[model samples]
Target chain A: MATKASRAAARMMIAPSVILLLAWMIVPLSLTIYFSFLRYNLITPTGNPFVGWENYYWFVTDPSFQAAMLNTLMLVGGVLLITVAGGIMFALLLDRPMFGQGIIRIMVIAPFFVMPTVSALVWKNMFMNPVNGMFGQIATSLGFQPIDFMGQIPLLSIILIVSWMWLPFATLILFTAMQSLDQEQLEAAEMDGAGSFSRFVFIVLPHLARAITVVILIQTIFHLSIFAEILVTTNGGPGTASTNLTYLIYVSSLLQFDVGLGSAGGVIAIILANIVAIFLMRMIGKNLDA
Target chain B: MARAVSNRTRALNTAVAGTLGFLMFFPILWIFILSFKTEEDAIRAPLEVLFGSGWTLDSFFTVQERSDYFKHFANSVIISLGSTFVGLLIAIPAAWAMAFVPARHTKNVLMWMLSTKMLPPVGVLVPIYLIFRDYGLLDTRIGLVIVLTLMNLPIIIWMLYTYFKEIPGEILEAARMDGASLREEILHVLTPMAIPGMASTVLLNIILAWNEAFWTLNLTAANAAPLTAFIASYSSPEGLFYAKLSAASIMAIAPILIMGWFSQRQLVRGLTFGAVK
Candidate 1:
């Protein structure tokens, strides 16, 4: 029974959050778009004159932009593949009745809580370092060469580190979904003489479809803008080898002080993120209606 | 629907799951162990370092002595708590309204709020940095608090809305019918009912803000540097000091890790925006 008075109060109550979020979103975004067209460099004290599409042209034509785009896709795709597969396997094992289930779940989910910088550094120096790292020590003791992880395959190393952090997230969500599956359906399938593989394929997987999609969409949003890990580990080093779009933009705008180029890159990143956001928003929108 | 399983099967499952779980958790466990070792022993072969190292709190002491650990820790506490507090202040009213007295466009508003979160922070980094610089807010805790508040507002509102929606409006209407004023009804009825949800929202937001690295690293230089920035500084040649690095990391993540453990179930709900059950 929303009367006129209560409806007015509702409007009043929602105004602060709505207006603040509007300002937060629109103001800086418009400014970024405005800066993308201008030739602005913090280091050079020249006037920021609008240069049409020149900044975008240069940023796009730069070979590094292509590399960053490729690396971004690879990193996102690689981590998604690893985490989703690993998550399913872990979720299945965890769903089975076992001793110390709580402790095992806690251990599996621990990495997700470790901040990116700490996780990256731990992986970089303690585990992946070719010389003084544990891997190196083991390799040397075993009369073999220690694989230079970050140096040899920077993106893959990053992929592994990020996957470790995210696998728990996927597993937790999927496991929750698995726990909610209809037991009668599984019993029915078993009674029909279906093997475990067939039951999993026909029953459990279908039930987990929504949760899998949720995990993928949510993870994609976060994975697309992976920054701190790359920053602390590679700094997109060895000449743009590990630079994602976010890292590329950071280097241009903040590190190199090329505001125009960075803004253009930012716009591109926004567009890329929006492409995925559209799918996510639609999915959530449908869920809301349901 | 109960199925009987043999004891051997149960033991085998436990052993396999435990081993895999330990493997997954070894990095953090190793860091925890190393944080107590001498610097020289921290980098030794894993087997030797685990079995032969003399345990000491030297690294913990040196971390604080060398790098004013408390300052960064305080910064993290202030920023994360401050942002969550401000976000709740703004979001609670909005979520309450949408939940109880939902307008026709309520779903649209919710989706719009979430869309802002989807806008990658990098996209607006240049302008926000310049704006902060012009306002003399760079490297300040207030700036971080403001940014993080905005960054997390959508999630907070979404979570509170989901929680509040679970609360039936008929209860409030009945309270009103019993002659309770609107303010009293909210204070005495709705708020008490929503406490658990709000507490979980606060917790998940704090964890998110505490572990936030991108904005914290980019915005703060020295004075307002949080644990994220503090730990990132150790990423240089000094990162070779495995024991000290481990100590710093353990300190940085300890509070959030505990909080995260408690909030894991809520985290799934919050992160997915209740899209999944």
Candidate 2:
């Protein structure tokens, strides 16, 4: 009876939020699904009659879709690689005895808190600008012609900026996890003649496996929809060189005012996100007992 | 011999680590220095002008004078705090339910909540915008707060629930057996025990809400504009003033940066709490 009463209470407590999300999710998704079949544009509202997947057909055939898809994949994959790799190094380094480690940690952690727009703006102007940016200055000093970072390699620049912003997160997680490891085991390994690399591989890396997965999964979710940096710096430009799926949706709905097509693009993004999420969730589920 | 070997390795590690840390932070540090430069000096080749010109607060003054710093700051404070509190209000009960009296679908429910977060806001953005427009809720602080709260609620609840779960259920059961009401079980017994978790959740949510740019930028115009929008406005192709732009960027981000510096440990803890657990 107590269990039943608690179960009912749980249902009651969660009901409002669940119902709200239900409407929030189903309404837009169903509308988007319905709109995907119609010739809908925000500018041209007369796309009322359903055209049987014509919108999807056009969206799939459009050259920008492939670019957007690849860009999204590259952005997500690229940042994850950089952040996770750099993060492990930083985390390990910070976990050991070092001078001014506190101050160094603070400096490293600062970028995570910088507003995305502000960070992007600073990078675009003070750091990445071809004429006066720090990068340009360094390149010139090194006897190499200044590279317009955004113009020449727009996606890579964005990826680097994001990696910087998120590396702290990965480091923090792995560091926290590393700190929690049993020190005796590490000393034991040392006493038994395990080299640094062997200890790191056998002990530290295993300890960080869950943290690494978390970093990858969480970052993937957020990075997939990265918009602020791209908007502030590149605006998906030099001709869609840096266009991601989210920006594509933005251009369609907000820029072109094509509601139907925009909604279609949105649905596609949702499906893609779900696919990534499903893979991540399955991995997490498998690792639950580990 | 062993001490010498360890010392040499340690020295090598420190040198490498220092360089990596410096590289990671150089852009932000350069931006801070550039914010104090004159427009002309700001655009000078970094090799020529860094630590070259006399530092001045003139850019800061101009940025403040040009933009209504207080108004934007106030809006940011209210929206971030309002949503975090509002989210806490709803999340407390929900988290309590899930943490203490979880149903069969508790993990599923939590996963579902988080999955909603993964859905690109653009997917439902048009409908929400239409709803907001039709209801005359566009560009209103209250509307922005609600949206921001909704946006961050799942993670807030997740974080709080994770915190709450660490509290033994037996404690709550004991309180109930003492003739305590449900509220007393939660308020008197449960919440107090979970203060650390709750505090971390609040701080983490505050940072998330403060840093949130997408919904704030899209839903807000002028009256409801926050710092994210303020920074976005600085990137006009015509201005070409890196100094003022960097100054504005600093102004827009300083409050949160200060807050984050203090709570960095707590935020990192909350973020990694569930992942490792």
Candidate 3:
């Protein structure tokens, strides 16, 4: 029902955001693609001659790159497994009538708000330090050797830290979805002799399917580029044990000044992210009209 | 929805959920306790540290004195608030337009905006770094503000759009039918209605921008480092000083944590872009 004037006004109002985003997406991306094909190094700012796919070959073939790729997959997969499972458990429990639910929820959600650096440092020093950490203290009191968490299992340690931060996010989303579930339908199933387990499996799980998908897609996007947690805790560690694609690119481009290799890695990271993004975009797009 | 359950079951459920919640919150609580203890006491065994330490505000003072903490805190406040404010300025009109006057491509525009957010920052790290260096915008607060503004613009617009979508169009139609000009219609009728949504959007974005680590860590050095970068500096030898690090961390996260609690409901909607709801 908008008039010609309002439609024109809408176009005018939308121009700045559209133009800015278009530029924001285009300029740097094209430069990254261009740079990926050249032999560019920031430190030695000499001739940057075009080189075809060599940077990609080297970056992909490098031993650290292989380790980084493995670590990235493990980190993302591990955290998703923990957070999603934990989130389901938490949502189920929280959905039940409980005492002090608000306080408990605040406590649970608090970690997600803590900045990555703070949370990483807190976990690293206060809770995981082998010499003086809480876990070490507990281990020693129980007459066991204190495990060096970051040293022995850097990727696992990161996954735990990240999981703690994100479990709340998944729980909150799932819990919100659960509130919309038909309680009477659940009751009717119970009346029809469905056990609690069967009811949960058949009714609640299906209802939660969409919310779970939303959680997985959104968390994957954030999880794929977990940077500060690794930076502050392990610095991609004892030997790139915890290095993800983002950290690997950061090290090469910013630290090593191999702009070409970093750009190539950046292009690959973009491509991988887009593969996930297409799925997410499709899901969100379907929801737009509804 | 409240079932007729026994008190024993309720109590059992409460205890289990409470314990799990406490475990999740333990690290933050531990740091809070550590922040108030002396450096020596903070490193003691967990039980000993809890039982034997005399509480003091020394570490908080020391964190302030040692690193000029307020400068970084101010930078964080400015960057997050400035970016959110600038983002709102650009987003309000766009969101309003899209919600009220959407055409054929409006949904495409929104989905595309979100797609930009998925473009991992690492993808353009090289060019952005080079551009910032060349333009002398590498370590400036204004530069950080601009980057964060663009970084968060899509989410800001999406959130405002979702919120705006809820406001009925008939209200605007009524306002226009009263011979109100477009400016008067927005200022008198729409802005007031949009204020609460805008406030929640502001709250969520500020929390996001404040805690954003990647750009703040990479783009800023000493002069313009926000709390994220400032806290990251503690990763070295300074990190060994447990009480000081805890104090610094508490200071950095406290404001956002409180804001987060208040905005928890909006967060699900904002982050998921209204899909779950």
Please state the interface RMSD for every predicted structure, separated by commas. 1.1, 3.1, 1.0
> Compared with the true structure, what per-residue lDDT tens digits does model 1 show for residues B131-203?
9999999999999999999999999999999999989889999999999987998899999999999999999
The docking category that best describes candidate 1 is high
Going through the candidates in order, state the TM-score of chain A alone for each one. Answer: 0.98, 0.91, 0.98
Runs in model 3 deviating more than 4 A are: B238-240
Report the C-alpha lDDT of model 3 over A146-263, residue by residue, as the tens digit: 9899999888999999999999999999999999999999999999999999999999999999999999999999998899999999999898888999999999999999999999
lDDT of 2 by residue, A1-290 (tens): 24787788888888876766667677777877776677766555684787777777777788998999899999999999999998998898887666667777877787898889888888887788877787888888799999899999999999988888898888887777787787788888999999999999999899888788878887888898898989888999889899998998888877887767787888888887887788666665553221
lDDT of 3 at A116: 95
Docking quality band of candidate 2, CAPRI definitions: medium
The single-chain TM-score for chain B of candidate 3 is: 0.98
Q: What DockQ results do all the predictions give, each relative to the true complex?
A: 0.82, 0.53, 0.84
The C-alpha stretches of model 2 lying farther than 4 A from their native spots are A1-7, A187-193, A283-290, B1-13, B47-50, B265-273
Model 3 docking category: high
Name the DockQ score for candidate 3: 0.84
Two-way TM-score contest, 2 vs 3, winner = 3
TM-score for the first chain of model 3?
A: 0.98
Could you give the C-alpha RMSD of every candidate to the true structure, in order shown? 1.0, 2.8, 1.0
